[model samples]
Target: MRWSKALIPTHKEDPSDAETTSHKLMLRSGYIRKLTSGVYNYLPLGRRALLKVEAIVREEMDAVGCQEILMPVLSPSELWKETGRWDVYGKELWRVRDRNSREFALGPTHEEVVTDIVRNEVRSYRELPFTLYQIQTKFRDELRPRFGIVRSREFLMKDAYSFHRDEESLDETYKSICDAYTRIFERCSLTFRPVEAATGAIGGSHSHEFMVLSDTGESEIIVCECGYAATDERAEGAVDPHPCDEAPGEMERVDTPGMKTIEQVSEFLGIEPHKLVKTIIYEADGRTVAALVRGDREINEAKLSMALKADLVVPAPPDVIEKLTGAPVGFAGPVGLDGIDVIADHTVEPLVNVVVGGNAQDVHLKNVKPGRDFKVTAFHDIVLVRKGDRCARCGAELNSFRGIEVSQAFKLGTKYSSGMNATFLDEDGVAKPFIMGCYGLGVSRTVAAIIEQHNDKDGIVWPLSVAPFAVEILVVSMKSEECTTLADTLYTDLKTAGVEVLYDDRDDSAGVKFKDADLVGMPLRVTIGARGLKSGVVEARVRKTGEVSEIPVDDAVQGILHILETLR
Candidate 1:
């Protein structure tokens, strides 16, 4: 595309309201314009970039045997209600009413709609494994829409859903899609990690999220140096807290006056935080249950929520907490509890004789033993892990970092199929619900994540993989005969050679032209200047690296190709 014919707006100052670099660059460069909070209107440049990304996604998804299909952006509320998602999905879902007052929703996702199609078409096991995908707009009423496209309420998404008759088929297809995602992110030039994911709200047994590591990321992923990593939703694996196998020490009580925090108590006793057992009280199933975890840990609320199978399980208030454990607000322990069930996090299990609450005011117990000193009705890996902890996989130390999730795939395992009675006839003529898998990539967020992972101080140094244009040919002085003649010739040469070029034919200054070229973030910039006319040498520059070379006019095409190959 020619720059004179394109809408590549360049700004000297960053927009005051722009919170993210991607948002600022995109707005200033005229890639996109905001319609409202959490809503955007893609301009010419952004539309081209989105089309390029969509093309790559289509190719990769099709390579993995996924068939492209278009589902309605507006879905019937009855379909969602059948899956129980309409009630459970909360207010994030946007609902509307038609002329008849029947409810409809702008799809947040297409699981129910896709499953409805599968339930009608796929009858026998022979036609079991099928994948259908689409690139479409999705709507959600985000509670706090921030970070631009990273958390937009209305955005474009590429969602693929796979249906299978059994677990083995589902597992095989799941692996195939994961591999496709690997290729997809690589093509987008995004540095990402596929970590184990939690199935919150979207109930599923197995899930994985592709997270791009960045300081601006909203979610945190705790990873062990042993290559063991999991997002909070699915990290219920067994983790031994690497306890010291010393003999059970004597039990004693120590007075802890006015110290409620773990740090305060640890400093008072002059012991490692790992040596203390932290007992937490919560209201579960209309009764108070005390959960004991290590001091160096935080409770995995998701795991606890799943274990209790309660309607809601959050941290209880001290007044409500004191009533259950028979102690003052700051003091509560597992001493001789019969009705109150105790849950132990994975880390606290290996402690031979640990210090815990004494079930009395202003006192705590030391050398307490599990099974011998206290009873635990349930055991789980609900402890929040931190650095220096051993890996659950290869015994390496753990580390933590924040990341933004750009894509996800999950084995839904009949969660909705069973609820909606989406069943097929079995060999014995009995109805069996189909197992399902869901895959999604944030089309808009991927664009922002690319900027997050790729940009530099100058502006967005768009990676060639997703750049709006491959080359930008700037005419330093569009009105000058020498510059215009050479610029016109170079533009024709590049375009005729099947290279995508954006020619800056505008009557602008050299500084403004160069600045706009950088701001537009095209990978290559070929400048036709006064020096080029004097020496018969045109300048070709690579945007990512501040490297420019003077090439003979006849060899301009070859120089541009070489630079493109080098950037690749």
Candidate 2:
């Protein structure tokens, strides 16, 4: 592509509203333009890059057993209603009415629609283990869309769904998809990690998210030094149980004037925080519930909510606590009560002698045994494992890092199939719900995340696998016959050798052309300058390493081809 014909609207100054590195560089380099808060318009350069990404996706998907198909961006509300997502999807699902008053929606996802399509055709389990995929635009009404395409309301995505006959079959397909996703990201030349993920709104049994580690990532990863890594939501760790390992002393009563916080009470009585059990009131499922955990650990809300399977769970308000427990917030505990439903963290359940609230102001009861002193309906992990905890997989130290989810694969296990009656017949001719596994990659978000991971202080350093152009040939002095003629010859040769070359044949200074070439970040750069031309040579620069060398004009294409091959 020649600069004279190509739409290379390079900018020297950054846009005011571009907050992310990808958003800023993409606009400044003439890749994308923002139309609104969550909407964007892809210019010629941007469209080319997106097309390259799509091609990569298509190739990788086809390499696996996936057959590509195009799905509708607009879908009927009746499809969503069949799966009961019409009410559960909340505001993110864009709902509309047609001219005839028929309801429709711009699909945030296609699980409902895809399953609905297969339900009519899939009758036997012999048709199981089939995968279908698509690269299409998805819409979601993000209430606070920011960080450019990373959290946009409308974006491109690659979604694949698989049908299975049983749990083992689903497991096999899930592993295959995970492997395929790894290859896809690898082909895109992204530095990413596949971490365990929580299937929150999607409702799945097991899922893994491919996260490109970046500082600006939204998801936090709890890491361990000894190869132990997991997301905060799925983190299972080992923590000291309030340091009460030493034989706890006998139970006792303490009276104070006005100590509310655990620190205050521990300091006033000269006791360690590990010896006291903290009591909290949570209002869940329309009931005022009391939960007791150790004073040292904070509660994991995701863990607590999953244990109860409640629709809503939150800390009980101040006035509601006083009316239900006959005490203020901090001073409520289970001492003389054995009729209330209570749950404790696994580490907290083994405490034979621990201090707890005495249901009054500035009072505490020590030597509290969990099962002996207080009755409980369940004993499970109610608190989160903090930093300095054992790993769930290999028992290593747990560390933490925040990430943005680029893709996820889940084992749906008939969650939607049963709900929508999408079943298949077995060999015995009995109808049974089809098991499912779903996978998705956010194409636009991946673009933003690649920039987040691979950019430097100057600008984005696009990888060869996804870069629209493999080499940028800049005529340093376009008006000079030697430079322009040599640049034109090199561009044609590189293109003939199957290299995607961008030729800057405009009348520009060496500095301006070099700066624009660097901003565009093709893997290889060829500079035809007067000094190099006189020496029968040209300057070749590596965009990623900023390494430049003088090479003979005849060897320019070969040298660049070698670099591009290595980078890809």
Q: Against the true structure, whose lDDT is highest?
A: 1
lDDT of 2 by residue, 106-198 (tens): 988899988988898888898888888999999999998988888989999999998988999889878988888888788777878888777
Clash number by candidate, in order:
1, 6
| Tens-digit lDDT string for candidate 1 (186-218) | 999988899998777777888899988888898
lDDT, candidate 2, at 102: 99
Off by over 4 Å in 2: 13-20, 224-228, 245-292, 310-340, 350-375
TM-score of each: 0.85, 0.86
Given candidate 1, what's the lDDT at residue 495? 83
Lowest lDDT sum, 10 consecutive residues, model 2, at: 240-249
Q: What's the lDDT for all of these models?
A: 0.83, 0.82
